[model samples]
Target chain A: MKHSTNRLFSLGAIVAAALMAGCVPPSAIKPVDNLSQIDNGKVIVVGKIELTPELEPDEQVLGSSYEEYRNLALVITDTELRQPADQLGIGALTRRINAPLGDNFFVSHEAQPFFILRSWLVMNAEIKVVSPNYVHVPGNAPLLGMFGIDVQPDDRAIYIGTIRYHRDTFFGTEKVEVIDNYQQAKNEFASKFGEQVQLRKSLAMPVMNN
Target chain B: MKGWVKKTHCFNGLTLLAVALLAGCAFSGGGRSIDDPTSSLVFGYMDMEEAPTSMDYVKLQQVAPRSEAGYWDMGTDDGIMYNQYVPPGSFKVAHFGGSSFLMGEHRYSFPTYGRNATAVTIEVPGIYFIGAYAYQEVDTGFFEADKFSIEPTENPSEKELLNTLLTMDWVEGTQWESRIKNRLAELQ
Candidate 1:
């Protein structure tokens, strides 16, 4: 009886220490840290999140193309958002679109007035890994690369794509300009991650987990 | 009758002695928490989620320790309202420690919840169910939540600070109750 009692007491001590370990706090995430990771000379695998607005039919909106996505939002933070730099990386992200001015839209909750890509295709998306310079645009490295602004290891190797208005989840029309830009943007953001795998946080809570 | 009375008294004495020794088992470097509920240790997490309330809920927030500005060693955020210039990470768990001595009521943020932005309260003491969310028994911390810790009650506004944090389980017997007791015991 004495032996068993002593053993139980010893075990309890060990368990107590283990529970105390997690008391240390976690650190904040930042943007520059995220961009630094991608500075690696080789191609860095980044998941691009594109948001397109669903719009209705309206003629004569100057820059508007046929019905399609507009005011595209691009997210270029680190894969896990575990660093302070990652937070900064998100700050440099942008969107491109042409809207009609009446109905206001939102990008990451920021109000947008430019484009309203009408809801059509399922809001669901498919992601892919692509080359840093996917689009041979004259200005930006490619539309997605611009999200990083200026990263290191390759100063001259433009990280951000300066190609005009190549947003994925853009709002507006599907005209000649729209089709051409959409195709370029699609190839730019597509990844083998598939339609169900979203790189961004889905903030909504599910009733159950699979 | 005298002999019988003496025998009964002797049995009672022996029983009391055994009970004291069993309950007071002390190891050289360890301490068993006092089972006396009157002075028992209790611990819990807190948060004050902002709601467009007619009456200020933040009035109740000022007494607890916040992750953005250290812990319960200070009073709650009810005084500041945390609206104007709350630090970036004010709601996460910052520091946690335990003691053999009695711990007082304390207000603290998360090892469970991330931000104090949306606050909620959790009382320590009694067993809580805590449902499907990750949790552990006092002796067995087999839960999934991260940055976890237990705060000693030395802080002054511990009880009032925790009252501000919100929770779905306001009633008894939920997972919240079971886990809270287990967590408090661990801290003690």
Candidate 2:
């Protein structure tokens, strides 16, 4: 009976996992660095983003220049997705990007501040399977590439790590150089994200309609 | 009477086996990678305008209004963190068509810590619980490698996420990925 019960539980887990994360056959679920850490590159892309009005509205951390008005976080991580608003016991979800895409997390706050409503998701390297969950997000650094860090001034991918907890809080490590790379990304992100800013604003029309 | 003794002996043996088996699968995986299929990690990234001076998160007592930001702390094992008892978000990092242990791989989180260009390693394997808190500058601390010691992290959590998802990890590279993959398959 105990053995059977265990089997039943395992089956349930597989089924439930399938439902939550679209039907990726249990076998297709590859092993990345973390077992539970689903490889977003394959199954999904792992990047979570939020839009918040800095107290100064003009203040930004990860951006290369305040003129760029954007910041890129590196999220050097070692944790799991906790709860909504990020509490514990929640299925592990994160905005951690190990191998980022050109469009991994481009946000046009200045161009489409309206479309800047808060949202989060996990995707594979392809940027496909974006599972966006809406929540009253508070704050998190995108792999924190703090400004003035030695990070580059041109477009580049900054490598960062973190130990995220399902419980909203996360811990990470970053370097001045990487922050610079992210800053570079920001420099270009602002320009690139700016082009789409108008369209992003246009997309938010429906929300405004409501 | 003799037959009863045989059954009792068998029962004891089974119990011992059960303990060993249960304990055998106690340890598991961490992190994620994209280009490297060999890695075992899955995480997201965000872009911020300004770095947070002091970043902290709290649980909302209710399903907060858009006017506010902060996480709601309802405790459960799975589903959208916003959905009643659902997990964080409804997304799946592909399960490597492996086995039960692989499934286990999908059930944990591993974080790496160090200054840029440094490697952190966890030499042993065991069950460790994680509790997150802001540390005094060192600014952001990744529970230093040596800090991965097995301890009771008195973090508040619902029975499921704590028991099922947030099982901790401290290992070399992302080896936990394959370790958990093989482990999860054994059960099936």
Candidate 1 docking quality: incorrect, acceptable, medium or high: incorrect
Candidate 2 residue runs with Cα over 4 Å from true position: A1-13, A16-106, A110-210, B1-17, B20-188
Per-candidate total of colliding backbone pairs:
89, 106
For model 1, residues A1-210, the per-residue Cα lDDT tens digits are 001111122222222111112231221211221223333332222212322222233211212221232333222222221222111121333222222222211112111111211111111121223332121101111121222222333221111222223232111112211112333322433332233312221111111110
**All models, DockQ values?**
0.01, 0.03
For residue A20, give model 1's deviation from the true position in Å: 19
- Deviation from native of the Cα of residue A80 in model 2, angstroms: 22
Task: Give lDDT tens digits, candidate 2, residues B1-188.
Answer: 00000011222444444433533132221112212333322221111112211111112121112112212222221121211121122121110000121111111111211111111111223212222212111222353211111122223332333233334433234444344444445534
Q: How big is the positional error of residue A107 in model 2, measured in Å on the Cα after superposition?
A: 2.7
lDDT of 2 by residue, A127-172 (tens): 1121121111112322322211112223122222111212111222
Per-residue alpha-carbon lDDT of candidate 1 for residues B113-151, written as tens digits (9 for 90 to 100) = 112222323333332211111111123224421122222
- For all candidates in order, the CA lDDT equals 0.22, 0.22
| TM-score per candidate | 0.18, 0.21
